[model samples]
Target chain A: MLRDFVKNIGYDDPLEICLSELEALLQYNYRISKRSAALLLLQEDPEMFELVRKNEAERAEKIFSIIEKIKPHYSYPLAYIISERRQREASRIAAAVTTVGKKGSLGIKEALSRAMMNPFIGGPILLAVMYYGLYKFVGNFGAGVVVDFLEDKVFDQHLNPVFIDVVNRFVPYPVLRDLIAGDYGILTLGFRYAFAIVLPIVATFFFAFAIIEDSGYLPRLAMLVDQIFKKIGLSGRAVIPLVLGLGCSTMATMVTRTLPTKRERIIATFLLALAIPCSAQMGVILALLESRPLGLIIWLSVIVGVFMIVGFLASKIMPGELPSFYMEIPPLRFPQPSNVLRKTWSRMKWYFLEVLPLFMLASVLIWVGKITGVFGFLVRLLEHPVRWIGLPSESAVAFLFGFFRRDYGAAGLYDLKTQGLLNGNQLVVACVTLTLFLPCIAQLLMNIKERGMRVGVAMSVFILFFSFGTGWLVYVALNLLGLNL
Target chain B: MVQYDKDDKKQVVPLSELKPGEKGQIAYLQAKGKNQMQKLLSIGVIPGMSVLLVQRFPSYVFKLGHTQFAVDKELASSIHVKPVK
Candidate 1:
């Protein structure tokens, strides 16, 4: 059977090659038929080789010699020769069996899609997408409108007081009451943050991102950013993780595994940590700066500027050949409402599930910290920097909350916002600092897991100092400019 | 009719519709480039080959058995086939 396969592949009939000497070759200790075993060997088929080696070791040696003689006849590897023969056979059949004609029209839609991938047309188009898909819709409408409805109407007026009453009545201890109903309470803060604050904002973000993804706009975004990305030593491919990091940096850190080179993955992980603000952070920042247009613009410029500058520096430090990039742009399909909804619903559910338990756990830790009076001590310790940044001492808690959950810290700022604690310049400074803050513990753990201890710890420490250092600089710059809210 | 049906399941297509990160098997390679297709062949993309679509964001990363290769989506769309079961 193996011998027959060889004859078929060698493109010759075995019967013609074998003659008077065939009987000797067939003997148990004789050469395993020359062309047949070599062809199977070229196919890298182990089973056939095992059978032939078992039945005729002596014969296999003789066949191996013939294969050695045949080897120099081709410049390429043997596997290439075998596959070229197979593809020729496949193409021949395809030619006979199928018909393709006049090709499909390369009409307006195709040309427009191509135009979108070019840097000149693509850059402004990307800004339009961010403005419409992200800023106006998700940031303003979802975080502003939807969150106001839930947090103000639903939680502030209805849910929180009721939970407060329940805890007050059921619990005898003042400490326990506060643990469940007081500041940083699981029900009052955690659940509220998840539902009232993060929910509407993320739901809208995922909806917008789904449209971009399903339309196959991501690859084009990659192409548009390729040159700028090259300065950071990554091809345009890093755009996927960077884009996704906006949704959740923790997941984006894990997705870094998909990058082609180790250098790209490290650069991506570092950038995600430094500049990309996840949805929760984005929602909070939007709320903070939405009232002050100048503040918002300044904050955006700083983050984007830092992302590029740091990326360029990392690219220079990291040594590797930049992998050439080629990505598929699926035809831009009109985003189906149902598919968009399903994707949004699923992604939101996944995000909520991953965060809910952690939020609950953070509440427990704070409860313990409060019980031990350690929470107060930590707040006092954080107050020096809070004051240094010109933030009110009370803002220390939000900075603490940031370490546990990056977005939760931002939500804490929302609490401060309602109290009118942050003026325009202060809001800008706070937003800048938080955007550069270390990723939440989840994303940090993922960074350590993916990039390992040395790379991971080193990155987090650099970011820790850099976040405060930059925050301090921004604070001074804003103050010196004498801009008042 | 096809669009209506695709609404229910994922918009799964034949190998010719392979995007980055999609997994499929090679049914055939139509048209030419028949000679230089050795890169695909050496990586085990001949007929009856199975591959996992790894990264579809920037390009297509297909892991054929063990070897990983990236190709532009256009080239991927050119390879016609039934998907892996």
Candidate 2:
């Protein structure tokens, strides 16, 4: 049956002649038939070419020569021509085997799917999803309520004091005690931040994202945004990584590998690093600006404006082929509870495993920096720029923390806000600057790993200056407008 | 309605020109690169297959067999089709 099937699916005359000629020359044993191997070689399958070269040795050159000879027969690539022929055969078989039925009228699901692709309707739908899914569920509940409860009630009330008391009694050295249980200790600061604050916010975000993905709404959202994305040198396929960036930019940076072009990956990476704040940072910012609506609006406007302008400028500066968009639009379906839970749990576990150690390491690094006076020096250096951006010099600590982890920095700002240190204008400027700040150390390493070192370091340098410059502009603009929040 | 040439019976136009609900048979792909051609072919967009334009706004969406796909205007324009009236 296999032999007959293989023979029946022969290509056009010129390709067939070349395939047979190449097949006759191939002496090596392969898992697939020589005909299929010959076809792959003709279509320029690099893996097959390598295998044939390794296995066939001297005969490989002859086989390649036959493949080269067949090239001028068609204007299109052999792969495309072969695929077109196969499709024609497949359609013929499909038409012969299947019976056609009368088309049915549009159902409620179909209408809803259409409405989702409609710009006017989809715009409101997207806003509603973000407002409910991100703002209310992740921000208010996860970051606000859950974080507060865990940090204040659980960790502070029960865990930290017990750990601190036990460490002080058992540990002999003051420095060791500080390292293990004091203010910037692994137990008190690192573990607390990871489990109490970042965990809940990230968990809620993953849960919400899982539901959105399972419902098959992302492709529709991508379709609606393709036109706008093209203006920034990205195709709608980039929406996946960009949305995932909201959950965790480090993970999103890795996801940029799915993009078709280097240019798209670089642009997406830049945007994720620069403008798209992770859920943890966003939740803290939302909480910080909750009281001052005008401050929140200004921060939002500034961040969004920076996102577009930077993306547009990057597209023009980077030279490459424009990204082309193509994606399957799966039917929208109700998300299954079990699937959502499983996805959310797996992502949370992956994130926690990747991040917890880094948080602990950050705590140790901060401790080292404090003892060595490096942290103080860096904070003093950051203070100049912080002051330059019209922020109080004290907020420099948060900017330093921003390098360790983007959310850690935002959480630092949250502490400042609680102490009533930042006024409305200052709060907005800080938020805007911090949101546009460099990606966390983890994402920076990922950027380097995924893109080459030169591009990654280049982007980081650009962001360092651009973020502060944008923040300074926002400060001047806000003051020039003379509108008090 | 089918479009016709003065010299021939069938007139070919880029698939992007088709309005929603119009039907066409793909004539050929004028893809500029091997990557684009591979992507289109992997999705089963090939000569002789019937295509139905489902939506043309924000992006171009079309149906091939039972599956639906969305492509940007650049990709859509590369697909030359003959209208099926």
Candidate 3:
């Protein structure tokens, strides 16, 4: 039946002649039929070409020469010609077998899909999604309510005291005890930050993200943002990784592989490192600025401004083909609760497992740095820049923590906020700087793995200076403008 | 600028020129690269298929059979289509 189908749906004269000539030359047995192999060879499938070259040896050259001879017979590519012929045959077969029904009226789903993509309505809908999904639920409920309960009630009240007591009683050496349960100890700081702070925020974010993804809104969102993305040297397809960057930049950096061009991937990676904040950090920032809405607004504006300006500059400076956009707009539907929950649970599990070890390692490293006094020296060194940005010297600890994990730094800032060390302006400056700061260690490794060592290190170095430069500029501007909030 | 089919002398326009709700039969693709052509072909945007322009702002979205697709203006402009009355 397959042979008959291939024979019946034959190509034009030139292709048919080339196929036979190539088929006759292909003496080695392939997994697929000789005819199919010939067709793929004619289409210039690179893998097939390599396979045939290896298998058929000298015959492969003859096969390729036949393909070259057939190429000039058409203005379009042989692959396009062959595909078009196949589609025509498929359409004919479909028309013969299928009957058409009268098209139905545009249903409520259709209208809603249209409304979701309409520019006038779409902008507001996007804001609503962000406001509710990101701000209210993830920020307030997850970061605010859950983090408070876990950090204060569970860890601070019950878990930490018990763990500290056990370690102090049993552990004989002061160094080992301090390493396990001291100020920057694995149990007190590392486990506490991961389980109490980062976990809740990440869980809520993944849940909300799963719902949005299942609803089929992301493609529409991509369509709506395609023009803006083009300005940044990316196609709308990039929206996936950029949005995923909100969940976790490390994973998003890995996802940048889906982009077609190297240039787009580079630009996407740079922007993710510099501007996009992961959920844990965003959650903490939201909580920090919840009291001062104006501070939140300023932070939002500065980050967004930096995102656009840097992206535009990158696009202009980097030489490459402009990314073309095309995507299937999946119909909008109500997300299934079970599916959403399962997706959220799996993502949360994956994220937690990946982050826990890193957090603990960061704790151990911090402890070592403290014992060696190197951590204090680094903090003191950072204090100059921290002070230059109009933040108090103590906030240097937060900046140092930021290099380990972006959220860790924001959580540090959150600690300072509780101490009332940060005023309104200082709070916004800290948030912006930390949000644009170097990616965490895991993300740095991922960037190197994905983009190679040189580009990864170069991007990190640029981001380190650029983030502080932007922060310093924001501070100077705020002081110059005399805006109290 | 109006484009005319040299063989039939019929007026054809880039798919981007079609207004929302307007219908057209795909005539040919003026793709500049093989990659662009393959992308359009893979998405079922072949010649002879009927397409309905669904939206024209922010991006050009069109319906082919039961599926809807969104393409930026540049990709949309590569597709030449004959308007259906």
Candidate 4:
């Protein structure tokens, strides 16, 4: 039956010629059928090519030459042409063999799916999702409420004093004490930021993201945003990476590999680096701006405007054909609780493992730098840019922390906010700058790994300058307008 | 809907131009790059496959079998198709 099936399915002329020639050449006993091997060869499937090269070394030359000979015969790619032939044959066989069932009218799920893709309805729905899922849940509840509880009641009240006392008594050397339990210590700062501030916010974000993904709503959301994305030279497919950027920009940077073109990847990377804030930063910013709605609005508008303008300019500057997007829209269904929980757990584990060491390293580096006066020097220099953005010079500390992790910077700003150092406008400026600042160290490394070193360095440098420039612009405009929140 | 070379005078239309509820059989794939072609092929959008326009508001969503695809307008336009009754 399998042999008969293979014999009956015919390919196009060029592919057929190549397939027959490959059948004549390949002598080794492949795991798959000769027909399937031929088809795979015709499609230039790399694994098959490598296998052919290894097994049929002498005959591989003729097979490759046949493929080269057939290349000129097709207007479309060989893969496309061959796949089309297979699809046609498959469809014909399917139609012949199957009977039509009664056509069902569009059901509730279909209607809901369609409503979510409709621009008018979907736009408001998206905003609601962002507000409730992102702002209210992750920002207010997780970051504000939970972080406050963890940092104050749990860590500050109980754990920190205990650790400091124990480390002070056991570790006699000042440098070693500072490294383990002092001002810039690993336990006090690094573990505190990761566990107290970042963990809750990231956990909420992953939970929401998992539910959305499982519900099959992402594709519908992508459809709703496709037009706007086109203007930025990205297709709807980029929604995956962009949404993932909200969870963690470092992971999102790696995910950009799914984009089809180099230009799209570069543009996406730059936007992510410059505009999109990760969950922890987002939660902190949202909490900071919670009492001041105007500041929040301004921050939102500035960041969004930058996102669009930068994307538009980058697309225009980088020469590439407009990205083409096509995504399979799975049927909408209630997200399974088990699936959602499993996904969220796995993501939280992955994220915690990835960030724990980085946070520790950052603390150690800061400790070392502070001892050598390097950190103070850098903060003093960064004070110039901080003041330029209309922020207090003390906020320079946060900017220095930002280089290690965006969340760390936001956490520093949170500390400053608690101390009543930042007013409404300065708070907004700081958030804007931090949001648009260079991505975390991991993301920068990922950008280099994925997009190559030159593009990565260039992107980071461009972001560093552009973020401050935008922050300065916002600050000057706010002051010039004399708008007090 | 299948038009051979003998019926050369008939105008060809892009699949993207089809209205919702309309059906079309794929005719030619005028992809500018291998990436475009490969992506379409990955989802079984190839010449001679029948497609139905499901929605076209925010993006173009088409149905092939029970599988539906949401594609950008420009991407859809590259897929030439013939109207089917």
Best-fitting candidate, scored by TM-score: 3
| DockQ-derived CAPRI band for the predicted complex in model 2 | medium
Model 4's chain A TM-score stands at: 0.92
TM-scores for all candidates: the values are 0.75, 0.95, 0.96, 0.92
lDDT of 1 at B68: 47
Q: Score candidate 1 by lDDT.
A: 0.75
Instruction: Score residue A66 of candidate 4 by CA lDDT.
Output: 84
lDDT per residue for candidate 1 within A300-415, as digits (tens), equals 99999999899989988888755445444456677888998899889888888998888988898999998899999999998888889888888889988898889999988888
lDDT of 2 by residue, A125-201 (tens): 99999999999999899999999999999999999999999998999999999998987799998899899989999
What would the TM-score be for candidate 4 when compared with the true structure? 0.92
Per-candidate DockQ values are: 0.10, 0.58, 0.58, 0.70
Candidate 2, which segments miss by more than 4 Å at Cα? A1-8, A28-31, A50-55, A96-101, B1-10
Candidate 4 deviant stretches above 4 angstroms: A1-18, A27-34, A44-61, A68-81, A92-100, B1-3, B8-12
lDDT at position A159, candidate 4:
97
lDDT per residue for candidate 4 within B18-81, as digits (tens), equals: 9999998887777777677777888898777789999887788999888999988777888888
Tens digits of per-residue lDDT for model 3 on A9-69? 6876777777778888988888889899888887778889999889887777777878888
What tens-digit string does per-residue lDDT give for candidate 4 at A375-405?
Answer: 9999999999999988899999998889899
Clashing residue pairs in candidate 2 (N, C-alpha, C atoms within 3 angstroms): none
Query: Which of candidates 1 and 3 is the stronger one according to DockQ?
Result: 3
